[model samples]
Each structure stands twice: as C-alpha cells, then as structure tokens.
Target: MSYAVPTTKKLIFDFIASRDTVSKGELLQVFDVTSSSLTRLLDEMTTEGILEASGFGSSTGGRKPILYRVNPIHRYIIGFEISRIGSSIFVYDLQLNQIAHVRWKMDATMTPDVLIHHAANQIESILQQHHIAPSQVIGVGIGAVGPLDQTDGVILNPLHFPADGWKDVAICEQLTAQTGIPSFLENGANTALIGEHWALRGEQIKHMLYVHAGVGLRSAMMSDGQIVRGAFDLEGSFGQMIIQTDGTRLQEGSNYGALEAYASIPALEKQVRTQVKLGRDTSLHPYAPEDIHFDIILSALADGDRLVTDLFHQTGAYLGIGLANLINVLHPERVIVGGPFMNADHSVYDTVIQVTRKNIYYAPDYQPTFSMGILKEDAVATGAAVMVRKAWDCE
Candidate 1:
C-alpha cells in the first residue's frame, strides 16, 4: 500500500531513523520550527504509532530531555532478488531488521509468470504468518539481473536465463498488481552494494565498490555516499571488460578474453569440462563432461582435486587482473567481492587478492581494502528492502 507522507514528517522521521535516539529539542534544532509546532507534530506522529518515547536523554542543563525513536514495526518492507540461479524474498521492518525469509532455486520450469506467482503467494503467506496486514506494507523492492528498464520496471532481454519467457518482462507491474503494493526494481549489483553500504553505515566509508561473481561478473560503485549509475542499466557490462587481447572467447558475440571468459562461474565450469574432455585425470571424471556443473567442481576442489585447483588458480589470476584495472581506475576506499561462487571458496578469493596486489597500480598512500560481502547471498534482497525504506523517508 502507498503511504503519502508530508515533507515535514519525512524530515523528522529521517532525523530520528539515523540516530539511536532523538530529543524533541534536537529535532527542533535540526529543523527550523516553532517549539509548539514541533511539539504538536511529534505528538501526532507518536499517536499515529510511528514514533515512540524511549525514555529520557542526558541533560545538558536543567531537567532531562525526553527522547523518541522510530517505531521499528510501524510498517514493513518486502525485498525480492530474482537471479538466474535462484530467487529470494525477505521481509524487514522499518529498522531494516529481517523478520521473515524464504528462498527457492531456479530451473527451466521457473518462468516469469511462474516465479512471480510463487513470490506473491510467499509474500501473502509471510505477512499472514507474521500478523502483518497489507496496509502496513510500505512497498516491495526487487533487485534483479540486468539489463533492466528500471524507470519503467521492465526486465529487458538479459542473456543466459534458464527459462525462455524472460525477454521484456513487465516484472514490477506484474508484482504490484498481484500483491496490491507498489514495487520498485533495480540492478542486482547496485542493490547488493547498497545493502553492504547500509550495513557499514557506522564506518563512514564514502567510496566503495562491489563485484558479484556468479554466472557473470556484475559490479557497482558508490562515491561520496551516492550510487554511481551508468547511462545504461547494464550491470553485467563489467563482464565485457577485455583483460587479454589474445585470450579465448568462449561464446560468439562476446569479447575475446573478457572478464566473464575467465572470472565467472560458467567460465570456470567450462574450463574444467574442457580439461576433463581432453582426458585430464581428476576426481570429476566420474561425471560426464556435459553433466559437470559448478557444484561438482566445488566438491572436487574440496577433496583436493589437482585439476580443479589449477583451473581455479588460473581463474583467480584473470579475476585479479580485472579487479586491478577497476581498482586502479576507481580508487574506491573499500571493495566487496561476493556472490554464489565467491562465498563458496576462500582459496580462490585469496589467490585473486594476491594477483590483484601484484598487478594493481601503486598510488602513494592509497590502498583499497578488499573483503567479502557481509550479507553474502542475501545482500541484494536486504538492499532492496533498504531502498524501499529510503524512498519512504524521502517522501
């Protein structure tokens, strides 16, 4: 359901939401308003269950001041992540605390209609189970693979989908109609970075970059606390970065030796399959080359398979080369690298870091710290929810 909030209330809510507690005088000082007018506004919001008195604050002089906080359960937000590998739904309160969650794998059967219907059903079931009404739901936010028509909320023709009916899908309209709630869509990589940024708000890092390596390489950046979106909504364009001029191009129409040709999970799987087909002895030989998958390779690596380890080393080297180029150009304060495959293995991550440091341009007194996403698999979903809350605050 849509909520129409006055600009004054939004400013008040924004002030309170960013802090642990806010006194009425503090609000008055932050915003220019009469003492009696501010008191009335606070009273109205408190009566409306949007804000609650959370006891008193330390007194600078005279009596202690009454502090207030945004009611965490005032309204709920829904976040959905639709990716080629799987989809996840998460319910969060105004404070962005996740209260309910569900996830499901994707296959050829999970077409646009099928997946959206399932998501609507799950959302209904979650709200009912949590005793939250439809009116209490602020809106739904979706972070999905690109390229997306974000302004119109359409899923443009993204490549490598398991299903065939994904081209030009009106995902936001369908979701909003099915669930009777306003919905917003964004690129998955951007949402993931937003999610991580929210988690690290206390750190006050102004510049950051995020890379998610899965079926493809997706990336997003933030500078001076604002997300840096490109003219075109193509998050996977990072995959087209040419790391090697003479490198192999696995698919037609792809750049030779692009980042995806080496860093992505599909590329890693293809590498292993090709080596296995060439009669390279390894633990994964039990499965046919066509049947080999990313999970199978991970299992083989877990067992210390020599063939899988060598291929990972090569993949990490290429991935590091790509990261080096990005870091050198962007010079972000922090870089987060995580997705399905990145979170699954630490050895590959370590190798990528080593190679990136070896190849990255050295700038005096500049070193970008690299780490995996704190939210991990749930990063995009959580970020979607955060965006919804942010929109409400803006309104």
Candidate 2:
C-alpha cells in the first residue's frame, strides 16, 4: 500500500526535514491544499509525533502562528559500508549527523559469520557509547559490494571478496537479528547515489546517474524521483558493458572488454607497470609497485608526464564511451562521477566530457550536465544513513 496522504506528508516531511521550523500558512502554500485540509493533516501529524509544535512565530498583526519541526533527536540510524579493503560503521542521529564512526580492516581469511559478528560488536559498542537505546535505533542500512538481492538481503556473488562457504547468506536478516533492528542492504554504488541525493538536495534532481570507479566500475540510476533497482537489484552493473575487444581474454566475472578493464585504478596501475617494464618511463621509476596507485598516476600527470596523461586520457575516453551508451539509454538530467580515480584531476573530467560530447546521440539542446559526485568519498556511508532515515519514515 502507498503512504497515507502521501503528497501531503511528503510536503510536510520535506519542509520540516529541510528547515528548523515552518508555519501553517507556509505549509498551506507549499502543498497548494485547502485551508481545512491542511489544518486536518497538520493536526493529525502533530498528534502522531511526526511533527511537533516547538514554539510561536513572530506575529505580523494578530496572534502569533505556531512553529512546527520534525523531531530530530527522537531516533537514530546505523550505517555500514563494506568494501574489499575494509568496512566502516557510522551512527547518525535523525538529523543525519555522525555521532560515531568505526573503521577496521578485515582479515583476508575472515568468513561472513566472523565479519558480521565483528560489525555487530562495533555497532553495539557505538550504541552503548552514545547512550542510545536499542529501540531508538530505527534501522541498519548496509552498502555492500554486489551482485545483491536487495529483496532478500543476500549478496549472491561478490567479485572481489572471497565468498567461499558464504553464498546466499541473509545479510539483513542476520544483522537485524544481531542488532535487534530492521536492516536494509543495497549495492554500494546505489548507496552512493542515495548519499548524493541526501547531501546535494536531490529532491530537485529527479533524474541522475552516479558512476563509481574504484577497483571496479559500477553505476546507480535514479529516475523519476526514485532509485531504479531492476530485476533482482542488478540494474546498474555497467562494468559488464563491453568496451574493448583486443586487450585481454574475457573471463566469466570480468567484463571481457569492458571500460572497467581500462579505466579502473587497478587497470591504470597495470598500464604504468607495463610501460616501466618496456623501458618507456618517466618519474615512476623510484617507487615500488605498491606505490603505483591512482593517486600516483595523477601526481605524475600533474607534473606533465606524457605517458600518465595519455593513460588518463585513454581511460577517460573508454569511460566516456560507456557513459555515452548509458545516456542514450537512460536520458538522465545529470551524471555524477564518483570513486578515487574520477576524484584525481581535471584531466579526467575534460577527457570524459570531450569524448562523451563526440559520442552521445542527444541533440545539442538536450545535453545532460556532468560533474563529480557531491558526496564523492563518503557517498556509500551517507547513502546508508539516508536509507535508514527512509526506513524510519516508512515505519
């Protein structure tokens, strides 16, 4: 079933969520509803604890109107971002402020049970530290590597992490049982898009795409004021879109000739390593292989190193091809690039823009805006928190 008085509640919720307080007249104008209707809804909401009259507003001539606001301190949320390198946990108040954060690297041999236990322990510690009651924690939102079955809260087969004996584990159910709270699981990239939406006033941007490029590339689509999770939540797996045909042999999980093979950070590092072995180098000679990260490549490009610049440009072009295809299909209003590689320098942006412009099928007047993500580095965590907030509102 849909939300009761969905339009009215949305208007009220958005107003209170975005501002410190609002007046009855303002609500009436914002919702474009009759005075009687607005009064009924506001009164109902105030009685339901969704909205509270905090004080009186300044009077213009007659009696002072009452000010109302959402109760920000009455609830809390826990957000988790699970990556191959490590996992991060954050406790956010109803207003989305981070009350606590914990980050710890995972042992390479850690199983799903062990990892979940560790996470549960960290969450319990944070809740205790903040003196937050278990009931006050509305939900736990998890952003994890995919392919995920969000409906079932199961991570089917993550590419990088060792699933081993952990296939089809019920992540949300397990976490919910462990923490005594509801849990929501989503693709990491999707979470990043949610985070961007929450952080950048996303209610205005009804259609947009968020591209996450780190060790691998994935994308999340937000269209018509909602995140699109296609057939079993596998909609935004752009990494599998084929882009090249000559570089390497195709594998099962690997997108044989996909843009990720050329544009991902690991791909760039491999390119640099190959150039070094071919004795065609510049400034990367002194550092070890471990030091050849995306940042190092960007630093080399900044110094006007021709090889690294060419690599970035090449990577950007490949990324542009993939994105251009996406634009032709989705027709979003904007595309926000995230992840460590896209965050490096303007060269990447310029290259992606130039190539996308040349390849896109849209008319000149229909060009979609492209920019870096608003919550670039912390998008996953922020999205997780937003997911929790959404869950709380639904309850």
Candidate 3:
C-alpha cells in the first residue's frame, strides 16, 4: 500500500524561513513529525541544495543535532520598480542583498512594447553584469504604478504612464515570456510597506501601514506581517477616499475631494504654480514651471521659504486627516510615511502630527507610533526582491 506524502518538507521550510537557524529536533517538535520523517525531509532538501547543514547545536546531555539553514546562494530573483519619473531594476540573492541595480529615465514617447523590451534588456544586462546564471534566477517581482490587475499582471490605464499605452498590458506575462522566468506584480505602495516590515527597528512588527506621497498618494496595509491585498488588489487605495466634500475638482479616475488631489506632488506643484502665477511674494517665483519639482520645493522650505513652508504644512494636514481615518479603521501599530513629499522639512511632520492629533478621536490618548520609512526610495525595489524569497518560503 502506498502511503501519502507528508508535508514535512513544507513544515521544515517554513520553520527555517521564520527563524535564522534551527535544529533537527526542534523541527520535529514544531511539526509533530517522527524523527524518521523529519530526517527524510531534511536529507532530501540537503541533497537538493535548498537547505544546508550548519554547525552543531548546543549539547543536552547527549549528541548535539546539526543546525540547518536555508541556502543563500541557491537562487536569485530580479526586482523591478516602475515609477512615474523612471524605472529601477535590482538583482537580489536569497539573503535579500542587492547585488546589482539599474535605473533610467522613462521615455514619454516609447510605447508599452518598447518600454517593456527596454526593461527586459536592462534586467538581462544586470544579470550578465553579476555573472548570475539564468537557471538560478527564480523569477521577477515588479512593483509598478497601479490600478493593476494583479491576477493577470496587467497595468490598466495607469495615469503616470498614460502615453506609454499601459491599457490592458499584461506586463508579467510578457516579461515572463521574454525572460523565461515567473513574474509577480504588485502595487508600488504595497511593496513599500512590505520592505518597511522586513526592515523594522528591531523585532519585526506584524501590523503596520505605509503611506507614500509622490506624483500620487497611496497607502498599503500589512496585518500579521502579510500584505492585505484586497478584493482585486485594491485594498489600500486610500488616495480615492473623499476627505473634503467640496474641495478642488477631482482629476479623472479620482474621487472628488480625495486627499491625493490636494497632497500629491503634482497637486503641490499645481498649487505652487498657482501661487507663482498670482505673483505671490516668494523665492519660488524665480524657478520656471519646468524647474519646479518636489526636491526643489522641499529645499525651498528647508531654506526658510515661508510660502513653501505653508504649502507643505497644508499638504501635511490633509495627509494627517487621511492617516487619522486609517488609524481609526485599521488600528495599525505603526505608520510609516515615505516618498518625495515626506522628505520635506520637520515643519511638514509637525503639521501632520498636530492635525492628526486634533482630528483623531483616539488622538494623543492612543496614537499609533509614526516614523519615516527606513528604506525610503529603495523600499519598493527591496520589497519586490524580498517577495521572491517570501514566495519560496525562504524569508
């Protein structure tokens, strides 16, 4: 009679993935499997080069069991991020160290096919640069501008890459076909949240929220250390939440009075431009519309430009209002703000704290801890690479 295959291998993989190291006996105890079964699983994994036997464990009045760990050089993954201004590609080993990176400005005139082909070429170049073999590359994880169909990896009419013909583009399928590797797609903000979780202050925090304010504003929620990909992967579309019933006119595909309309980089630039057009007395007037950017405005604020300071304060207040709502609903333990706008002066953060405290019912009595993201600009790319290891239950 044929016996059913046990899940010892999966159990061992999960146990080792969750911890830095473990002993064979601990694995048997955790999974409630017999020593023979555990040994079989470990032996098979060791033979496959998926698990490596480390040094001996501490003695317990008997023979010390050999320690086991997931192999770091067993595989590699490609991580890609498509942003409004440009794109970035990273090669990561199973240990989550970035071995190589490539970034370039996105061409406005390039069609989707051209852009994807260019991305593929860049990834290939990065792999070749690192001397990584094709067979060892597990897959590609892409964190891209959304409204994406995550199931099919199709970018559906993204606002940032409008001219790039993003409508119904099966990005993952195409990349997979070109590279002969599996592909996974996720929202950029969601990936940022994952990266933040992976790189926490000390112990990994299980529940957190990541808010990204750049050309657009978006939030991603993580519960129990896993991303909450909502129905159709739209769970964290906080940018569309209406905060003001009668505020500025909404951009196409945006909800009227959403915080993003008033707080995103484009929104900030538009407001700044309007101020300049109206001949406001400020140093920003010297900069042409093309010269105006998030970094420029933030530097202006840092240099004590009152007009820029006031604009960021207002923007931060709006962001605070959104964060208050999120805190009340999700009650996350931590909230991390990242992206271009978050790089502004402390005045912006002060405004956010003050406004959030005023608006939130819980307020100072029970505020969720807040901080800037640890990874900052690298959050999305790092998360995309970590996603591959996570998929294989290696990290």
Candidate 4:
C-alpha cells in the first residue's frame, strides 16, 4: 500500500516472479511504455540490488538479451494467520522460501489487547531468533477470517473469536504501530487462494477457484490472474447459497437449507453425533458422547465404519452440488478444495468430484481440474507474505 513504489516497477517484479526468468525484450513486448522508460526502471532496480542479471536469454537475429531475476536473500517478509483456535506466523525470503515459523493455540480468554500483544511479541521473537532486522523486513501480512473491510484493513466482528469488545479492529494499523513494520490484511480464504496461485505460478493459471472446507465452507476466485473481489469484498458467499429447499434447517426460522447446513465440517460431525444419540452403534466406542471429534470420525472411517462413511458421503454430495453451481457460473479452469476436510479418506474427495461432474451445468468442454493445495496448513500464511510483496513492490 506504500505510495512510494511505482506500479510499473511492481508489474515488472511480478512478471519476474511469474516467469522463472525474463529478458528485456519480453518486458518491452508486454508493457505499453517505450524501451527507454523500461530501461531506466530496470537500471534503477538493478543498481539498488533488487534485480540482477541472471544470464543471456535466447537470441532472435540480434545479440542476446540479458535475463533478470530477484535476489532471494535481499529482503524478507512475515505472514500471519490469526484464528480463534490457532494463530501462525512465518518469515519468508524474497523467493517465498520460509525462513522461520511460530505457532500457538489461542488462549480461550484472550482479549483484543492481549491478542495484539501476543502477535507483536511473537513477530519480534521470531525476528530476533533469525537475526533479522526490522529494517530488512518488507512488512507484516495478516490473513484473518473476514466479515472485514479489506480496503481499509479493518477486521469486523469475526464469528469464532470470543474476545470482549472485538469490533472493527484495525489489524493493519495496530500491528504497524506496535511493530513499526508495514502491515497488510486480507481475507483468510483469499490469502489461501493467493498461496495456491503462487505455488502454481509455473502453471500459468490465469483463473482458478479455491474452496476452504473447515467449520464452514468459504471460497475465493482468481480471474485473469487477479482476485475477483466484488463490491465490499463480500463476493464469495457459497456457504449461504441454498442447497436443498426441504432439507434440514441449520437454524430455526430459516427458509431454505443452506450449503453449510449439510456440507461443512461441523455439519458432518453433527450428523454423526445425532446418529449416535439416536442409539446407532459406532466404531468410536471407547470415547464418550462429549468426546466425539472429527479425528475420531476419520479414524472410524479408516476402520471401514459404515456410519462415518455415510456421513462423509452426504457432506461430499452436498459439497459437490455447491461446487457445480460455482463452476457453471465462474467457469474457472481449476477448482482447488482444501482445509481440514482434506484429511478425510479419498472416498470423500472422489465422491465430491464425481457428483460435481454430474451436476455441472451444460458445458461440454468446461472441464475444471480439481486438486488439493500442497502447502496444506501453510498456504494462507505464505499468501499473506505474497500480499505484502505485492503491496510494497520495492525492496
């Protein structure tokens, strides 16, 4: 968000990040400006040690053009994910390689002030441990669960965090004030999408849809290589979308059944718990009613438990319907499903994919490759780092 960095320079830097290496001719052909202007910017960045010549690129009649790349160790950034259950932070080098990481379970009674101090302290501690100076840091990036004002970097009332007086918290401003490092904030789902994109940069994927299946399902889209954040950054509301008209209600007084009511992690677990309460036998015998958990359900599924598999089957079927609705409308080439739900057996993933193809709206060639994020838990945090890099575009 720094006004000091030029947009053109950022575009060039991003081009280098996207392509493994690039020559001046490629930048000239891509950018609208004259070669002289591009040369000046490249020269200035090179002089500052942000960009360096790798070697000569392929020749086409004339002398070969010199290739430029980013210096990986020139600077670093910290990306953070603040959640009610757990918060994690990581320091990444310029090339997006993680240098250090710290994670902690949230204190159940943590207040807004305590939460801020905890994050700031952890950031400082990690910096000291890695012998990194604040001056060498690009910024601190935060990806939090949102109902947030991303443009203003304000976190609105989050659903899970039970902190006292936690309304409209200015996460970016507060963290910047506390740590004196520039800060950026984004939707956790969006950050995870960005991380997926960064990891798959070599694929040259211009558009993709990302689904996070945790307590509830949330999604973000990348269209034409940019985040498809609609007005108010409130576009991705796939969870609230109706799945069944006469299906079970999530809460009383709601009209139609929503996607999250049947497909989310909590929903799946709730079904299992209900079946158990109804005197259904379970493989999860040693555990009491209160002790039933998602892990236990997964363990039972591994043991070929019929009840657990049926529960997952229902959730997967409903989720596939939701994904089909999105794909028919969005038409993204890639659809990535991730989060805690991925830990389940492949039957769930396979069922979801099968039902998705069946329900896909009429498009013969509209095949979207569905896959899981390899970064796993680190996707959001790493995307936060990329956000800061995109924000500050300069070394």
Which model is ahead, 2 or 4, in terms of lDDT? Answer: 4
Locate the minimum summed-lDDT window of 10 residues in model 1.
Answer: 1-10
Best by TM-score: 1
Displacement of the residue 258 alpha carbon in candidate 1, Å: 1.0
Quote model 3's TM-score: 0.90
Candidate 3, residue 180: Cα displacement in angstroms equals: 1.8
Tens-place lDDT digits, model 4, residues 193-283? 9998999888889999998877657799999999887776552367778878777766544336888788877788788888887778777
Error of 4 at 87 (Å): 2.5
lDDT of 1 by residue, 123-220 (tens): 99999999999889998999999899998999998887898899999999999999998899999998899999988887989999999888889999
Instruction: Identify the runs in model 2 with alpha carbons over 4 angstroms from their true place.
Output: 1-15, 18-20, 29-49, 54-62, 105-110, 162-166, 245-250, 283-306, 393-395
Which RMSD values do the candidates have, in order? Answer: 2.3, 3.5, 3.9, 2.7
Q: Is candidate 1 or candidate 2 better by TM-score?
A: 1
Q: Write the per-residue lDDT of candidate 2 for residues 75-182, one digit (tens) a residue.
A: 788889987656888888877777988887655666788888888998999889889988888788889888788878887767555335456878899988898988
lDDT: worst 10-residue window of model 3 = 1-10
